[model samples]
Target: MLVTEKSPIVIVGCADDNYSMPLATTMSSVIANVSSQRQVVICIIADKITQANKNKILKSLKKPNVIIEWLIPDYAKLTNAIISRHITIASYYRILIPELLPEKYQKAIYLDSDVIVKANIEKLWDTEIADNYVLAVRDMDIDATYVSSSKGLQNYQQLGIAPDCKYFNGGVLVINVEKWRRDNLSQEIINYISNNQQYIRWHDQDAMNAVIAGKWSELDPRWNSQAVIHSYSSWKETSLTEEMYNNVINDSYIVHFSSSAKPWKLGCKHPNRMLFFQYIDLTAWAGWRITFIRKLWLKVKDMMKKKGISFSQA
Candidate 1:
């Protein structure tokens, strides 16, 4: 909250009404870990978020030396966007940061709503961009096998992406906003989203990988430690050895919940789910737990689906 002469560490997140609480959790965890010496400003690409939710976020994440700014973008083509119900219009808001943000910010970190910073954020913020379009960690969930076996390599080749390039998880990105502007990358991403739905499978994530393949640099996996239920199966999927993956998980600076099954929802089953609640308990929405009814309902649904027995048919 101190708007001093110190260069602020800019961080951004995208959220709608349902996601604001998780977004606040992400912000609070980061704010709690960041050293007081670091002047930070938090930016949210808010989409149809309620005033009540904004108040809740402020109440939860109130802190000095950190400023929260909201940007409500008019996505005039919202209806035209080929978006899945789960992936809201706000998800694409991140791709427009270079143009949407003030020209003063040369760089910033874009985090997803379902992540929490465990270690000091300056470890990520102060990292050198290495002159790439963006700096990101290799997706732990997106394995070499999937990339090689699925239509992934074919799709990348079709889209002119290099075959040898890595597919990054878009949960955390150290964006070079100045370079994005200089190269007119925002417009390019917008155009890709508008006209290239056939090629984009993971919404803007696929678009980003395709648009800037081999143009981005890698960071330590500890920076964006993803996967909700990581195990030996997860290690088999990635390029990492068992020992290496364990080190990454143990030393993760940012813990990212990248899957659709979130910590707040009933029957999440992930070990990291409670980690999300640790920060949420600190928020205005404390004592909020998943209802037993919801848990029982989800269990029944999962059982029926696994057994291939629909309720209607039964």
Candidate 2:
């Protein structure tokens, strides 16, 4: 039976000139994987969007058990507001986590657009934050002190965060809505950015790390496991065995391709990118036909590049 209470997952992603359809397909795949009893509220923010674009977005989001909210940042002057506050790109995601969430749910999981869901998300929703804290996935890439070094220890010192608190990646977070409301963390965060705009490097991620460091519970890496260039290379060399890859696809609650190589791009070599196409069940044969042709082109280009390489001559 599908768990209904505490089962809704909230996510936020932006639309740009380059990619929206693929992102929509990714979101649809996410909705399909979750239990039918669960609800997904997605906030899509865009600037100077057109009617055609809006129609395209709506078509992609017309999924079962999904609620789509269109947020025009320019309509509310949020774009200007954000820049005036000197918010960084990383901070954008953090800022929206609270604002875009449904008021009814006390908790919600935030996911970046560059991800696909492979397992049911009820497992993540069921995790308890007994310490009255939120949960975040650890950044497997950077050093633990990178965020702390960017901002002085004294800044976080005021937020009740330890000087040596574990730095987390905000890409996937299980936020405590009640704590956020009680502490007024959302406004406080925006206020801090407005005040100390010059001191930030990574925008909201930096601010979030500065504030929510020790306060957050670390989630299992399996939940995120974003495929980056180095990890992809290492896997190709040896580390990512077939069994491991299959386990990641079958068992992972979410698969985030959070790097430069988006699946829609020309040379997306990540193993998980392949899995992304697997779950994207195109309702029409024409759509499937286009995707297959694209895949074939990618394979041919890859072969040509390999054949043309001069490793021995070099």
Candidate 3:
């Protein structure tokens, strides 16, 4: 393929051994949707990812115009980063992308492993970043008001952040690598996470929001339709209007499975769960299936639905 002279779309993703499949699935979705004219460079910040899984990821993304770069992060610096049952220390590796990637690349798009791209990413790459630190979608689940939810910034008052400031989801970030490097934002966010460990609920995401509040531009919600948008009650809780909600639900460019009930899991009811599986089937983990228990449960649910009996997991 003859690539264009335009700057290659640089994408950065982080993963460990457990997340290798999801990362590969994310890369596969990007490669599948991206235009052939543009060159895409995918940088995987690896943390103890096995050779076999790396091979699987490579096999999943077999595009002529797409180049892959494997980066080893400085784990020593990330040792103290907090992690939950589902998230790993690797989630903190995105903070290092500005310093780790080659200087020639001034900007990059960072996507979490638990997402699927449904449109040509070149459009997102072309967003006018100007002087902003990052372009991200407003987190639909977290309330901007400090008193509304504990999930919101716990120390917003202490951090001097406004009570009504918008909080962005770190899952999809259009980062201005040049600005991040110049301002030393990476270390600053790290320090915030360290100092506010007791108050930090969402780890790097909370730190980024605190350190870069009001600095990031908001992208269209369709670019990152989070799991919360699937339900009417949850979507209504967000600031999204009815028209905006309809647009995002009907035509999401990227479907982010940001909730704990992931598509790969047995009882996930996200509207895009099947869409996620479609991309997974295209990957090296083709024909991957949920356990027999899950399959049986699905059958039972289908039978109940046929009898007009609604089923909901408690």
Local distance difference test values of all predictions, in order? 0.76, 0.60, 0.84
Local error of candidate 1 at residue 162 (angstroms) = 2.2
Model 2 segments more than 4 A misplaced = 1-7, 17-19, 72-93, 100-102, 131-133, 142-163, 229-251, 279-314
Q: lDDT tens digits, residues 207-259, model 1?
A: 78777878898888888877632754656666677766777767778888776
lDDT accuracy of residue 85 in candidate 3:
55
Candidate 1 RMSD computed on C-alpha atoms after optimal superposition onto the true structure: 5.4
Which candidate number would show the highest lDDT if scored against the true structure? 3
TM-score of each: 0.87, 0.70, 0.89
Ranking by TM-score: 3, 1, 2
TM-score leader: 3
Misplaced by over 4 Å in model 1 are: 1-5, 77-80, 142-154, 228-231, 234-237, 293-314
In Å, residue 188's CA in model 3 sits off its true spot by 0.6
Provide the RMSD of all predictions against the true structure, rounded to 1 decimal.
5.4, 8.6, 7.1
TM-score of candidate 1 against the unseen true structure: 0.87
Per-residue accuracy of model 3 over 1-314 as CA lDDT, tens digit each:
12234989999999888688888899889989988888899999998887888899898887899899998898787767997655678889989999999978899999999999999999998888888999999887645423225577888888788777788888999999999999998889888877888988888888898899889889999999888777656446657887788888899999999988878755689977888778989988987777687678767866775676644321
